[model samples]
Target: MDWNKAADNAQTLMQAHEALSRLMPRPDAPQQTWLAYYRRSAAVYTRVAEIDRGHFHETMFWATREREKAEAMEQSALA
Candidate 1:
C-alpha cells in the first residue's frame, strides 16, 4: 500500500481507539463492543511497533485489515 493509504488507516484506527475508550465507562454499553475495541487497538499498536522495528509490509497489512474491521464495528454501533 502507498504511504498515504497506510497513514489514513493508522489514523482511522487511532480514532476508533479513542471512541472505544470514551464508551468504556458507560454502564449501558455492550461488553462485546469493549472487547472489539480492545482487539482493534491492540492490532493497530502492534502494527505500529512492527513498523518502528522496520517491518513495513507487515505493518501495512495489519493496519489495513484491522482498520477495516474497526470501521465496520463503528458503523454497526451507529446503526
Candidate 2:
C-alpha cells in the first residue's frame, strides 16, 4: 500500500466533510435558515450519539455545539 496516497485520500475526505458540514442554504441566508441548518445538524449528531455508544461523548459534543450555534442565532435575532 502507498502510505502517501492513503494519507492524501484521508486528508481529501476530511476536507470534503468539513466543507459539507459548513454548507449553508445560501451565501446571504436569513437567520431562520441558519437556525434550521444548525438544529438539523444537532439532530443528526444526537441520533448518531444514541446509535454509536462507543463515541457518545464526541457525538454529543458536536450536537451541543450545533445547538449552541442555533441558540446564538436565535439570540442574535432577538437582540
Candidate 3:
C-alpha cells in the first residue's frame, strides 16, 4: 500500500467527516431528527479513513462494527 495515497485519503476522509458534522442540525431545530443521518455519514467517512490507513481486514471488521452502531443509533432515534 502506498503510504502517501493512504495518508491523502485519510486526510480527505477526515475533512469530509468534519464537513458533515458541521452540517448537523442545531439543538432546537425542527430537523433535529436528521442528526442521525449526519452522524452516520461522519461515521462512514471515519470507517473509510481507517481502511485508508492500510488496515484492510481489520478496518473492514471495525467498519462493520461502526455500521452496526450507526444502525442501532438510527433505530433508537426513530423509536
- Enumerate clash totals for all models, in the order shown: 0, 0, 0
Kindly provide the TM-score of model 1 when superposed on the true structure, using C-alpha atoms: 0.37
Give the per-residue lDDT of model 3 (tens digit) for 3-79. 13332344444454454455545666553345454445545555575556654455455445546756776688799
TM-score of each: 0.37, 0.66, 0.38
Cα deviation of 67, candidate 3, in Å? 1.0
Give the per-residue lDDT of model 1 (tens digit) for 1-79. 1112343254443443444344343555575655465455556556565545555555566556656766776778789
Worst 10 residues of 3 by lDDT: 1-10
**Residue pairs clashing, model 2:** none
Better of 1 and 2 by lDDT: 2
Residue-pair clashes, model 1: 0
How do the residues 12-55 of candidate 2 rate in per-residue lDDT, one tens digit apiece?
A: 32332353355546767777777877886676667666666777
Return the clash pairs for model 3, or none.
Answer: none
Choose the strongest candidate by lDDT.
Answer: 2
Best by TM-score: 2
Off by over 4 Å in 2: 1-23
lDDT for predicted candidate 2 compared with the true structure: 0.62
Q: Which ten residues in a row have the lowest lDDT in candidate 1?
A: 1-10
